[model samples]
Target: MRLPRQREAEVTPLHADAVRALIDAAAPRFRALYLLAASSGLRQGELFGLEVDCVDFLRREVTVRQQLIAPDDGEPYLGEPKTHESYRTVPLTKAVVDALAAHLEQFPADGVKIEDRTDPRKLHHRTARLLFLNQRREVGRRGAWSQVWGRSRRIANKALAATYDKAHAAWVRNGRTEGREPARVEVPDGASLHGMRHFYASLLIKHRENVKTVQKRLGHAKPSITLDTYTHLWPDEEDTTRAAVEAVLGDVPPLCPAKSA
Candidate 1:
């Protein structure tokens, strides 16, 4: 049966500066969480599920074996990763590693009771040192975490807007008439915790990372999924083609000699 094609939604990743602002504006308790989100391409659930043992400090990597699943009617529990590909070891940048180290020092890991649902046949209870916890020192619930993210986003947006206003005022006072006025910067309302994941993807793309590498980092099952989401972020083939041809032919002499003019 034929159906109307829906328009692909545009993905506007958080700008690098905005990401910094967001992290800066986030509560001290969650600063590392936001930084990790932007640095590692882990999903919210994976971040929620992280345990002290998941991180390998010497290796500079985090193992993704499980995720925190929050059900509507019941409590959050530990479950298998979304897919097999999701169970990967994601490398960490030095900056992220330092941030994590500082965070651990500031907020010591607490042993929390985790309900394990990884084995569907039987549920198990275990105490593990979770990486992040709410104010009550409990495993963070998705809803509460999202609310905190929303508050941080609003605070960051206001700070950005104020900075833009101050710059615009200065420009007007200086009577600068050179180029078009810079566009005002504001983190979009649509930006959410997931936007940090998109920001991470953009970072990989900016560094000219290959499709397969980006796919692996993001834990996508296939390269096609990565390309489908971020194809536009890649450099245009036309530009590369032109540059290649120019490099080869730019200094060559004309084949035919011209007559005296």
Candidate 2:
């Protein structure tokens, strides 16, 4: 369904199983990347720019540090966030913590190395010493270690597209039809990596988490932005809230009363 431009959008929640399937299909690097984005509401650049140092397991927080910036050639560079709001800390979940831990084990602190079979030196010369590097390494060699903002964005976009395609195909194979026609595929309407952030926000609200808490988690410039965007997700709980409010407003009229005989 198309949303009105004037209306702020609420994040739509995906089924738990579907969410898991999506994450699983993105396996290896992309899977971990997907979890971080969905759970933390991190922008693509912010996620790609994360370093090992950014994770604070003891504190259960991930600090906002550098992000990937404009890339020259196939490499990406490190850069500061565009705005102050974009630079904010994120609280993590056990799933996120576990995903990160597993990612570290697979990738390690040493990083993915780049190699040039023809001229190893040339490959080393191109690699940028950024958080997300080419998943290949050239031993005893160093590259330029520039920034990788653009490259990271490209990678994320491609990965997201691939996921949608896979999901679409799976839907078709299951004999799901769109409308009255036998559907060839079922693609989500305008689903993007950012949609995952919306999913995260809605999840928090569903759990009765405070708007301010969601605001901080999403690093919005103001709490209003969080409230405006997600208020629709919550129903008017006036009847339920009345009892609680009456405790403080003792002078208030009774929310419900017995009928007169």
Candidate 3:
């Protein structure tokens, strides 16, 4: 049986400059959210479900223990990750550590109550030291974070637009305005909070990390899944291959080193 083609995941990974712009535009409470996404490649739910205990600054790692599931009928609650592999830990960069630390300083953990899904009545209350909280001061919900993300994204996009306008003005002065206007490359389209994971994958591939390494970090069930998701992000191999071969072969000694005279 044939399955219908799935729509491609719209991905527009933010570059360093665009990311920095978003960071500059974001408030202190939300700064860490963006940084952790880019640095760790965690899913939105995993980030939302984080407890105060999940972060280990000393270890510079975050444990993906569970997720906060939002349902239509009842209040959101804690649940296991999408897969068993999704329960793995992810290492953090220095930037992510700093962001998280600062965010904690400003916004201390709150004792928000979420139901225990394992319970039959769904009446069990567990105290969650949620990272981001909603306007009701509860753990941040999907809509709340989505709103914040959208605002920051808009600010960054506007900055990109201003930059393009400035460039176009200069181009016109130089008598080169007849062609296509400068591109708004920094402006990403429809890339939501989840897109940060894609950006993180690109970063790993850009630094020449291996597929298996990315798989482990991303908590993919298998290597093929990692490849299927991010094969395009891997750098061109021809140049690196040539350089690798030449580095070793070029310095190799002749079949026999010349005998001393």
Candidate 4:
């Protein structure tokens, strides 16, 4: 049987305000989470699974440690990053630092002091002491205290759905959906938080970053994937290509040199 090849996923970048609006509509916890995911290019689970220790406010860096996984007939488990290199430290922007700092303040802690480090796994287990804890923590459920990992995914779809409905209503009122509320904007298909990662790569390429730097920032298995995937964003070659051909042919006409002389 011939199997159909899957099409490449379509990714659209959300404007800063649109992202802010989306997060604003969500609950407080999910709001902070959404901004982190959109800004940092983290996997959905990574956002919920993140610990305060993973963020380095002064250094402006965040590390990916463990992720949440769902298996049939079992509770969610925290596992290592997708690949060895997947465990990476990404540079943080001013917005991210401000958001995280505000979040930490909003959810005040007891006597715990926040640390500056990466290693998602180490931070995951250590996060048990954080002020923002899973609901299960309140009831004393085993294997559930630090498992707020599913929280973001639970709200991402709903928030996106609300955004869709708002745009739909605008279309009903106006002859054409224009301005910020377009008739439609492409959101990634199912299981495609990876598209957000692609969005980050696009942003880097648009800024004219070198391939090796982008690769290191993304923590890809190697530089090849960075070059192969984002090559389209790079500027096209110059007209020297045609000049090379003209130069080579200029030395000789259609006939041989002896015949021409």
Candidate 5:
């Protein structure tokens, strides 16, 4: 008997405006984290695993040296990135660099002793100056991070809803009630922290960045994987074909025009 094929994962990236709102609404300590995630496309684990040394302010880049791995029965620890390609350097936009700088100024980095398991053969212990830490000033765990993200999402949604309410009121005051009431504004349902990574990929595609470049920036194992996931976001082939033909041959009159009624 043949097994059924699995459905592809849905890709619903946040719009630019929504990203801005979320970043603005995020808690001060985590605001830069959100911006970096959206800008760099680093996986959640990679973001958590960042150390002070991983970010180069002068070069405006963040190197992916390790990731935070949380096992079923133990605490989270530093480990190697998911794949060889994941160990790459991602460039940062000026805005992201500024935000990171401000974050560091507000909340200074602190050294923490954590287990390093980047190599499976040998586990090492080291004191790392982590870029981000939990409220307790220790290494952040997945569960705590998720909770904070959820709280931030809720705050953002409420702020968006309030803005919509204000706009609707203005529309009513302007005597423009010709149609049904506009629905409340909220971030897409089921939009999680991972959506920021998707947003980053969408931004790269929008800027006409080539597939190979996108793959490298996102640390995808292969170009095919990037294509498989983001093929739809690219310019439509049919539209490109028409544009190419139009460029070669100026607008041609229809071969057979319908007779005037």
Candidate 6:
């Protein structure tokens, strides 16, 4: 039996506003992490593996040299980038940089101990100034962080839905269904933590960035991968060309003559 190949992962950028709302909904310790992920497009593990030095305020860049990984039997541990391209650096947004700066001042890193996932018996002690620490003053665990993010995500989505309902209340009261009032703007419940990376890609595509630029910014292994993932987001250039031709030369006769000519 020939089975159909599964499609690539679905991309739905939850967007910056929703990202900010989620950050706001999270506890103070997690605010910097959320902002960094949204702004820099870091994977959850990359964000988790961040050391204080990963950020360069003067250069306005953040490096993705490492990531945290958890195994089925062992504790979570930091490891090198999964791919060579994943070690690239990315520019950081001012808001995110500032938020991180503030976060560092408020919460300093105290070396957290974790069992290396590579070898359960071999424990690794992290001396780097990790950006995030839970209430126990240790690096975030995958299980615990997942639960935290799930809770905060719901809170942020509910808040957004409430705000949308209030804004459209008048229209609903009058039973109007047209215009922006009818538009639905609720947060995406389907989005996972990696959606922040997709959200960043969406913004870059919307701003008309080139494939190479997107690939580099996203740390994609190849331009083809980036294009394949985001080709749907690109505007229809062919349609635009047709429209341009129509606007400028619609009144003119066809360049081709009759069949006899």
Q: Candidate 1's residue-wise lDDT over 1-261, tens digit each? A: 989888687567888878998999998888998999999989988998899899998889999989988887788899999988999999998888888899899888968898998778988999868788888889877678779988898999898888888778877877867456756766787688889999999999989999999999999999998988998898765558778888999898768977789
Top candidate, metric lDDT = 1
Q: Which segments of candidate 1 are over 4 A away from where they belong?
A: 177-180, 239-261
For every model in order, what is the number of clashing pairs?
Answer: 0, 13, 0, 1, 0, 0
**RMSD to native for every prediction?**
4.7, 10.6, 6.6, 6.7, 5.4, 4.6
Model 3 stretches astray by more than 4 angstroms? 1-12, 118-123, 167-183, 239-261
Q: Global lDDT of each model?
A: 0.87, 0.63, 0.80, 0.59, 0.87, 0.78
lDDT of 4 by residue, 1-261 (tens): 988987564444544443444466545644566666766777655654466687888999888775554445654445666667778888888887888788777764332233322454464323333424343332122344223323334455466667788877877689665655554432333423455566677778778888887887777788887776677676665769778988888677475457544
Better of 5 and 6 by TM-score: 5
Model 5 poorest 10 in a row by lDDT: 177-186
lDDT of 6 by residue, 105-200 (tens): 889765666544333465566466677777788766777877888888888888877777876897777777646564554457666678778888
Window of ten residues with lowest summed lDDT in model 6: 114-123
TM-score, one value per model: 0.87, 0.61, 0.79, 0.61, 0.85, 0.82
lDDT of residue 257 for candidate 1: 78
- For candidate 5, write residues 112-222 as lDDT tens digits: 888999988999888877878887878777677778888887888888888888878888987886576656756776787788999999999988999999999999999
Please list all clashing residue pairs in model 4, or write none if there are none.
Answer: 65-120
- Candidate 4's error at 105, in angstroms? 1.2
Task: Tell me the spans in candidate 2 whose CA falls farther than 4 Å from its real position.
Answer: 1-11, 71-75, 111-131, 134-187, 240-261
RMSD in Å for candidate 1, one decimal? 4.7
- TM-score of model number 5: 0.85
| Of 3 and 4, the candidate ranking higher by TM-score | 3
